[model samples]
Target: MFDSRHIQTFAEVVRTGSYAATARDLGYTQPAISQQMKALERAAGTPLFVRAGRGLRLTDAGRLLARHATGILSSIETAHGQLKAITRLESGRVRVCAFPAANATLLPATVARLAASHPGIRVELLEEEPPDSLRALREGRCDLALAHSLGDDEEGVIQVPLLDDPLLALFPAGHALAGSGRVGLEELAAERWIAGCRRCRGHFLAACARAGFAPDIAFTTDDTLAVQVLVAAGAGIALVPGTALPLLRHTEVVARPLTPALGRRVSAFVLAGHETAPVTALLLRTLSEAAKDLEPAAV
Candidate 1:
């Protein structure tokens, strides 16, 4: 419980071996130096100095405190410097959780931009879909989350809209609807479907329900590549986000926009009070810019 200021005065007194000289060196009056020593002795429960004929001599307790003061002060200074760096965006770490499609499309560009602009700000990425990413964000495991929702609101987080990822219809190259400019959900009502992650499957089911028919989902997987391969092999047709298409598209799979244009809204989520944190704000801005760059291809 020793005061830092008292410890500093004590260290200077020990070094100078004279109360008046220590006060002069520290720009404090000699009586002020003496008061600090008395207070420090009270906190330490032992004497820190003994009179030594017009000078000062350290007691055993004083020597012990002096031995450790340098390290303590150095650690305090280091902490201050690091905090300043973080405030200036010269050094920091941001943990980001995102879905697979966003990892493949949006993250690369965003990370690249951050690295180019702020090399000292490190980014760590984890892959998880909407609810899971949102869960991670709420649980304090991640600083930010790149999640997409079908117009659903999440609780306890601030959502910053980034882009709209339209769902595109996928079919085998020679399928009857492959050459169509656009296809409606009702037209494929009888076809077996390849569904993706849980949220995506839910979106698919809802879109189908709105179209007035239930789809028979035959295959389920989270991998976009596998989804494309299944559609190419004619196992079933599927609907995938436009962001996922550019990352992995099978040559024999034809992708066309859905006639009714079903899509999910992608956003960056941060804890309620963390939106203005330096690293978090920088990442949010970079993500928005990256999403804008992908607009032409995403639609």
Candidate 2:
């Protein structure tokens, strides 16, 4: 059997493509890495590397072993983490790729609770739209992503639904609808509409179309803040998530629920099966509980 160190060295060499680069990464001499690889090759009874001009390359057997070695190393690391967590060292890192709206409300309390409960864990917070966030999650750039849905795309991910975010109409405060608790989509459908989400903006527009008018597209932007700013400036009106309500600046903007209410479904996602990691599990539980705990109060 190849020694773990030798296996690691071999993997590193395969990863970097050159013994010298592996030496730089592992803080070892090139000769040392070469020796380790040679030892690993001997143990496997195969020539694991092929000499190439100015660098080294993995043979077929080397490529196969490298793949397995990478997995084995990861499993060992996770196992070590499990053992540490078993001793109350509850530790690891988790990331959240979420939209700014959710981050403003949900992430603060969730992370605070996490810090209090598991000081050993490191948490990273990022703001991204659902589509972008899910893409990041799939690319392994983040461990978790908070995404919004309109009751669609629930496939291919482990989703934990958070809340049904009430959709609201945003308008300049002194506008006719400010004091109105809710406005029908038709109320502003003919008004100039500066919107968000080129890809999904049609959903909101289509909802309006169902009410008998097409919105006048005055402008389009992705930044919710910018959208709200323009709306506050009387640039146009927008249908925005109520979760984004708290961040609206000034009394100039009033967010009132829309009648015939269009609400958005929000959810958290972790790559399936990866939810088992202790750190990820804690985050999932705490986040779901936080959402539940806030829902009634916020309602």
Best by lDDT: 1
The parts of candidate 1 lying over 4 Å away from their true place are 150-152
Model 2 TM-score is 0.70
The digit string of per-residue lDDT tens for model 2 on 1-299 reads 76988878887787788989999999999888878887888899989888899888788998888779988999889898888874463767788999877888888879888889888888898888868888899889999999887356546678888888877788898888889976888787668888886876767877877999878888988777888779889999887776766677765787888778887777889888977777778888999888886665343
Whole-model lDDT per candidate? 0.88, 0.81
Residue-wise C-alpha lDDT for candidate 1, range 178-243, written one tens digit per residue: 999989888998999899856557777878999999888899998788888898899999888898
Against the true structure, whose TM-score is highest?
1
Error of 2 at 62 (Å): 26
Tell me the alpha-carbon RMSD of every candidate: 1.7, 11.5
Q: Supply candidate 1's per-residue lDDT for 6.
A: 87
Model 1 scores a C-alpha lDDT of 0.88
lDDT of 2 at 222: 70
- Of candidate 2, the 10-residue stretch with the lowest lDDT total is 148-157
